[model samples]
Target: MADPLSPFRSSLLPVGVRELAPHANPVTAILMGRGGSLRLHLHGARVEGDMLLIRPGVVHGVVLPTRGADIIYLNGLDFPSDAPLAEALEGKLAQLAGGALEGGRDAVDELRACLAASASATLPSVADVVRAIYDDPMRRMPQGELALRLGLERTKALRCFKAVTGQGFREFKLWSAVQYAAAQMKEGALVRTAAMDAGFADTAHLSRVFRRVFGLTPSAAIAGLSVN
Candidate 1:
């Protein structure tokens, strides 16, 4: 089966009603309930809503609605660092959560539009780096070489990448690898094969990273899901 999520620049997944263990997401994301409201536990505090905007690096777990949910993972480089992104996005979520959006893909489009309207233009060099990583998660590109390519000092390059993506360069690379592995798994690859394809040291390494970032083992998250 073709990758259902291939057309999307941001990763979007439709998940059935389930519980996700607490984990620190590497990128900003939004979870919208499909047929009912959602309950999120953030830092031991609980909040219930039809839509929830998740900030990067926050430890949170969710109780999805009975019908299911649509999760949209965003590129943090698209938004301005100083803006109140969560508040603004929550407002848009409020508008869309009322059944205004059709599905996960449509929700992604709406959210992309919202971000584009207010986001700052990305730096050319930083954008290039992001493109390269997304294009080939398995590529070995060290920060020093990247800085040289961008005509920047290594420290400046690092700072610029973090500023644009809201994640350190290393963190972004790890997230890309995880996404790559997940994509391979969606295509029916075994955990070991997917781990190797994504450049992880081994299945155990992939499992640890996956759990820390997503709060679930790869098998638990990908098994039984219909990619088609």
Candidate 2:
């Protein structure tokens, strides 16, 4: 078998796994299928019928329906985190849950059509670029070394990234780092430890970014959610 694990760009599949496993990424996945059971461990979640929302860095095992299911996996980069369009997609999922079982065949066809249209589009969305950079931040991975690897001029590469993502390259880069680091902190990683582990200058640096993005210091946010 050809690795059954076929990996492709965000545009390539109805289902697949990401490399690096659990790199702190500001990405998400939307899975719509039937009769499949999935075990996911990560932040951010919501589900409906055969649909599932996946947070970045989550480890999971999915059991496809014995009868087989048509799954559509949408990554955050291609779909905004919380936006009107994404909300509309969520609405469709809700519709699927409410009496759309009878239309499973139609729904699957529709999803495949949408995927085809999305693949042929000329301009990528802002969400796509943001998710792309976030998916690989160290500038070490293939996606990270985009400009160098693709042999594109630095300026051109940045232009393409920004045009599609609606964010400055640097901004998305830092934000992606912050998101991953924050997730670790939430998992009870020590302040300084999480910060350093996340490639920050130190805990203080991480604290500042955390406050800026989430409107609360990392310590305060974690404290607010503490069980004890």
Candidate 3:
């Protein structure tokens, strides 16, 4: 049996005209040859950059330059729409655009091809994978295998993911699970089922992490759930 992957897709849009408007789709992008500024309302955090990453549900617009531009966009689904992933992609995009990143266009092409091929696959962040085991009380992921997938020694992978995500990979995975659990609870999932489906070891385990992150136990949060 194959390892279950998350659902996502990627597409490239040509840079024709620069216009200001909210992103209609959830996208992560690499803007190249951009001679103008891009403005993004990522959760109301005003972010300006030559390479903009518009995480899903983020509102953004761009100011065009008199000269033409070249752009690339990489979108994913398995990761959360947050600052960590956005920032990392932004840095990578900048390096690619400025022709300073290692492997040059070949590297960029390879990464793009990788994403395109895996559009139907679930590719978790290096951070999220680690978290699924360590920080998540419910799902205890095996570190050795995950490290191999990330192409790093187990210890090094652990360290690198932490430095980049601002949380050890395990921590992010658990938080991600917690967020999933919360959403499920809000949708009226029974505690046990919600815990299991969210990849937690058990309802008790889910409760513990939920409390740690939100300062409220899973049950308490469930009580406050309002279906709008």
Best lDDT among the predictions, by candidate number = 1
Please give the lDDT score at residue 183 for candidate 2.
Answer: 61
**Ten-residue stretch with the least lDDT total in model 3:** 1-10
Q: Which model, 1 or 2, shows the larger TM-score?
A: 1
Every model: Cα RMSD to truth = 5.4, 12.7, 13.6
Candidate 1, residue 3: Cα displacement in angstroms equals: 24
Residues 59-111, model 3: lDDT tens digits: 45445454424444343323334564243245543555444222254555545
What does candidate 3 score on TM?
Answer: 0.40
Q: Which lDDT tens digits does candidate 1 get at residues 1-228?
A: 212222225665556537778887677776777677787776667767777666667687888776567666765624323423232235645665333334455655555665443435666777777778888877757999779867989999888878767788898888988888987886789999999988899999999998898777888767535422
Q: How close is candidate 1 to the true structure, as a TM-score?
A: 0.80
Candidate order by TM-score, decreasing, is 1, 2, 3
Pairwise lDDT winner, candidates 2 and 3: 3
The C-alpha local distance difference test score for the whole of candidate 2 amounts to 0.45
Deviation in angstroms for 26 in model 3? 23
**Error of model 2, residue 23, in angstroms:** 25
Clashing pairs in 2: 77-128, 126-165
TM-score of each: 0.80, 0.45, 0.40
Candidate 2 residue spans exceeding 4 A from truth: 1-145
Instruction: Show where candidate 1 strays beyond 4 Å.
Output: 1-8, 77-110, 224-228
- Candidate 1, overall lDDT? 0.69
